[model samples]
Target: MMISVLVSPAPPEGIAPTFGWGTFAAWDSDLYRNIVINGYSYDFSRNEYLVAFFPLLPLLIKAVMFLGLPFEIAGFLINNLAFLGAVLLVYNWVKELYSIKAARWATAVLVWCPYSLFGTVIYTEGLFLLFSTAALRAFQKKQHFWAAIWGALATATRLPGLAIMFTFLIVSWREKRSLIAYIASLCSGGGLFLYSLYCGMKFGEPLAFLKAQKAWQPAQDFWGQDWLKMFMQVLVGSRNWKAGKIVDPLHIIIVLLICLGAYLLWRSHLKLGQNKTQFGYCILAIILWLLAGSPLINTVTILGGVYLIWHFRAQLNLLATYGFCSFGIIFSSGRATSAERYTYAIISVSIALGLLLEQYPRWGYPVLILFGFLLASLAVRFSQQLWAG
Candidate 1:
């Protein structure tokens, strides 16, 4: 069950884990390098100060290291805990408004996700998902302040946190709870802004991380690159600093399953018509995801199975939208093969899955298995990276 298995015996060849997975593995060396040397936390020093990875994830990892747990154990504890939180929130949110079946399926899809495993490996997605869902749940209950505050915390975990702000405003206006909603929205929106300011001071320039990213990889407008290139990266593998050897094309198979999901979404949307408020939540969540870009797309695109089974069924296409967006991202990816390259591979799998859904319909699953093999090949690639750590 533990993804950190490699760290135990002999980490394979070139693998380089931060802190050697000793007491500091969870505290990514890169993350702590920024924090410990200087009191200034966040990435104003290196890149886009406004919209890079959040500080909460780094801070959390540090806390684990500080607790004296080995980095692997610390990372495992934090990430799995975050995963549990994500699962709990999704279940409760679905159960609160819709049927138990919806909640159960949502949680299952999320928990079983191959991609979600990344979160369980000291990644940020699970923490972000947990906060995002909690924010949404709060909004649904008309708990404006709580929703905004939680949503803000979620945003601190990932850039898509803004979706909470957008949805809260929309729902508040719809329900005529304008004042409370406005207040909550401000609080939620302020969370990231405040963090950004702190990061700016630490880095010498505000939004330093933002500036650095532009310099690192300048993306043209309409950045999503061609679909084929995305496939090659996955089929072969991508070489990125962030994710190391990430050629996992397994998600391509998941994307293939969206066909039935889209049909279900259309039918369900038509069937539910105007009465489905939960669908609105999905819409808002999707919108937030689109804006967050990289991490969000990575999280959303590999969800072929889950989307196929969404309870509101009609909202299924909402799940499919990530594929289209991923097309745009592949375009943005440049000649340099970085973590973004593997990301393109993901984007490639996404939109391709959308096409397969429309065309083969029944043939989707087996094809996914094939693509998954391609992704699996990358496993060998990273053994070096992990061991070297």
Candidate 2:
């Protein structure tokens, strides 16, 4: 946070740069601040709608504002504190289920990943992660009441929290848990239900939040070609994909070389040691993702999450189920914007990556270094009011 504030460059001519803590409160932060100070508003003509944002973060900020703190301070404190709590919870939870080493690596990944910038900024990522992680941990411990309570708060914080509720309900049914487990699962969605009720009473539209999303990214067809475009952007460069024709022969050559390298690596795997082979694969994947830009990063975050969860499904159990449910919601949204941030919020991805890194400790160092560079870059971009995700 300090780095973001201190290192932000001056805005371009004729543009005012946000300074100090305010720098963290750009884009979506303004909407949250407005909601906190003046409550929700919907202005169709101006495309201004607070209904599009979930209420929990603003409400929490408002609660803190009663102490006479400004919205920026309140929001900054709330999000940072919640993120701290989340990291601690992740550490302890992973340590308990896995090992001290695994816990450390996972915590490092969660804290240093580029998307961690959202946790620092005025966003629901921190609060949502804290609540959802608490709910998942509680459910794993068979503490149904705590699970439902935390899960409810989670749902209120973000839509992905529905995945937590679904995970509990489905897992309870599959495991034939007691009625209390089932009841808790149903009760987990209380936050969303309450929000819906408020929307119905205020706007005469219970699904106003979902509808308001069109204000940001107009709804696309359910099985649209957007996903294909995103995939193509990953294989080719975004510019070439957007050109609607092969604008760069270099992109094609790079893609073919990557494929060839992968095939060669697989064929020669028996000759290489396990650690070397795994490290080589990791390096290759990172290179490919970096070359592809944000679209590929977003695509890989979601699809790679699926691959991770599925590969470790037996071990992850309910966590895997939650990951799938979250991904399903992202997929169903039919838009790719912010997919990377959303995927980062799913605790399963961190846990899975942590577990994998624990085995190949050698890979964790370079990965963490890379993550640190990306994290700092994102923080700088966000502070400059540029799109970091």
Best by TM-score: 2
Regions of model 1 farther than 4 Å from truth: 1-51, 70-72, 218-222, 226-228, 231-389
- Please write out the lDDT profile of model 1 over residues 1-389, one tens digit for every residue: 22433443444444343333432233233443345324343343445223355667767767777877654566557767876876776666556555565555445445443344355555566676667667666766777778877878876765445545665665566567868777896777666787678766666666654554455455545434423334434333333222544445443333333334545666787667744634553554444433332343333443332343232234433222332333333334442223332232221232233333444343344334433442333332232243111
TM-score against truth, every candidate: 0.58, 0.93
lDDT of 2: 0.86
Model 1 score (lDDT): 0.49
lDDT of 2 by residue, 1-389 (tens): 45645655575731245557787788899889889878887667878668988889988998999999998899999999999999999999999998999899999989998899999989999999999999999999999999999999999998778888889989999999999999999899989999999999998889888878867686555664677878888887787878888889787788788888888889989999777777778777877866776776677677888898898899889899999999898888677778889999999999998988898788888889878987887777777777787
RMSD to native, candidate 2: 2.2
lDDT of every model, 2 decimals: 0.49, 0.86
Q: Residue 82 error for model 1, in Å?
A: 1.5
